[model samples]
Target: MSGAAIALEGVARTFPGGAQAVRPCALVVPQGEILGLLGPSGCGKTTLLRLIAGLERPDPGGRVLFDGRDVTRLPVEARHVGMVFQSYALFPNMTVAGNVGYGLRVRGVRRAEIAARVEEVLALCDASALASRRVDQLSGGQRQRVALARAVAVRPRVLLLDEPLSALDAALRERLRDELATLLRRFAITAVFVTHDQAEALAIADRVAVMRAGRIVQADTPRALYAAPADAWVARFVGGAADLGGVVSDGSLLLPGGRLPAPGPHAPRARFLVRPGGLDLADRSEATLVGAVTRATFLGDRLRVEIDGAAEGALVVDAAPDAAAAPGARVGLRLRPGGLIVVPEAEEAP
Candidate 1:
């Protein structure tokens, strides 16, 4: 099925007691694009999804549009959208085929057509072999497939997934993430999925919207977002980057150990952000910073070395497995070009 473009204009949500869950925000998802709403718990990612699905109404002057048509006031049934919750929500008494065919039946579609569509979606989701099994008898992965098949059986204009893979174990979730991405691409449906896992969001979505406190901090492709985060919070949240507290002086970041060249001219009090991969071991004569190795961990293909006295606190670095570094060993650190990012220091929360 073809996808539809979704647009939200000035959308906001508030609880009955006047607690605002979502601040007014505008967003757009192009047709056939899978946009990942990524954030921590209570960041309003799910609330934004519910607003799009018509499960929750927006505040006054907010509007939702699909394919340039207004759908702001439509109920879930009339919106023609598909949704998959984290729980799967499959009926215990239903067979796989029965669950897949439920939506078509609700629409009063002809039985023969419903059967054909059910077969097609089951095949698409690689669940054809499980058609005869009861919902209670299927595995977590199989159940997830059945849920997705049911959602798509109605040929929805848009698909919304709320942590669809969260119900499975870690190994199973990792394996199914690739499969889910392939299935979404095959269907070519406009989809929005909410996820707290940074790797999951980066792996599956064409674009990611990083939300915080009910606001979108940055929206960009996975590579761009990782390469250049919008701020210190985004750098830490998206890439686990370390914040190096320092002052900028003469185009260099003055740290406790030594100075590293800064990106561009900024205020003297600007803090800096650096990814773990940005620091590398170098000879003492050529090093930009110096610190003592506090810990070294073997992570299959690489070594993670933790250093002390680098900046305000300890800093971690991704190093080669063959590097001869150990705990309590002194090492010189070189900041690669484009490695140090100047970011505004986080404001103190009132």
Candidate 2:
């Protein structure tokens, strides 16, 4: 499927009650690239996706363009954008092939053409073997595949997905998330997806536009967004980064665990964020700080330890899976230099 570039210029949305759902924003989505609209609930990510899909119009003076063609006033059908809802929204009574070909059939496409397109889409979505299965008999992942196949059957200019993987169980969601990314790449379709799942957005999107309180705070590649969030809130929300609560004085942080060099020039009380993996288990002699282990979970890959007395709140640290640190145990923390995320000191918010 060919992709279309999307541009939003000063786009804003207000409901009947004058509730500002989305603030004025400008964004550009390159052709064939996947952009993730990521934020918590009521953050306007969904509304933003709806505006792009033509389900909601931007307030006056706001313009939406597709490939430089004005499309702000176009209806949903006229825009030719595909959508995959959280529910999958498959027709339970119909067979997988029927659901996949429904849009083409309604558009007066010939039976042969519909069959050809259905077969092609089925193969692309890895649902070919289940072509004859009824939608009701399919699993959550299977239904998702059918929904994707149906969405792409008509060859849309852009594909919009709203929490596409939220319905499945944790394991299935993880597996299908990878499959979805691969499928989109194989189909070569431009896509904009809404997800509160940070890992999902980071793993799949070419770039992520992080929204907060109806405004876009930052938009960048996953690595950049995680490594260098625009603010403390963004840093916490994107990758579960925790604030290394301390007072900066004499070019170092006076953390309860120990003093560490805060390299940049700043006020005596500048704040910072660090990833869970950034801090390591250490001995008192080499420790950046010391804390009591409040909780510990050992997965095959790593041991996730939550510690107290390290910062103002619980600080999660990811250590080697084989490392043993049970709850109620004391652990030393070693902070890595590269893991420190520095933010501007002036704009302070809890």
Per-residue lDDT of model 2, residues 1-350, tens digit only: 46899999999999999988899999999999899999999999999999999999999999999999999999988998989988988987789999999989888999999999999999999889999998889999998999999999999999999999999999999998999999888989899999999999999999999998888889999999988888888888988899887877777777776766677677444568788987889886777688999899987799999999887778888999988798998888887768778775546321
lDDT tens string, model 1, 1-350? 47799999999999899878788999999999999999998999999999999999999999999999999989999999999989989988889999999999999999999899999999999999999899999999999999999999999999999998999999999999999999999989999999999999999999999998888888999988898787888898987889888777777778898978885767545668888888898887888788899999999899999998878878989999988788998889998777776666666221
Clashes of each: 0, 1
Highest TM-score, which number?
Answer: 1
How large is the C-alpha RMSD of every model relative to the true structure?
A: 1.8, 2.2
Which 10-residue span in candidate 2 carries the lowest summed lDDT?
341-350
Clashing residue pairs found in predicted model 1: none
Which residue segments of model 1 deviate by more than 4 Å? 266-270, 344-350
Query: Candidate 1, 148: how far from true, in Å?
Result: 0.9
> lDDT of each prediction vs. the true structure?
0.90, 0.89
Clashes of 1: 0
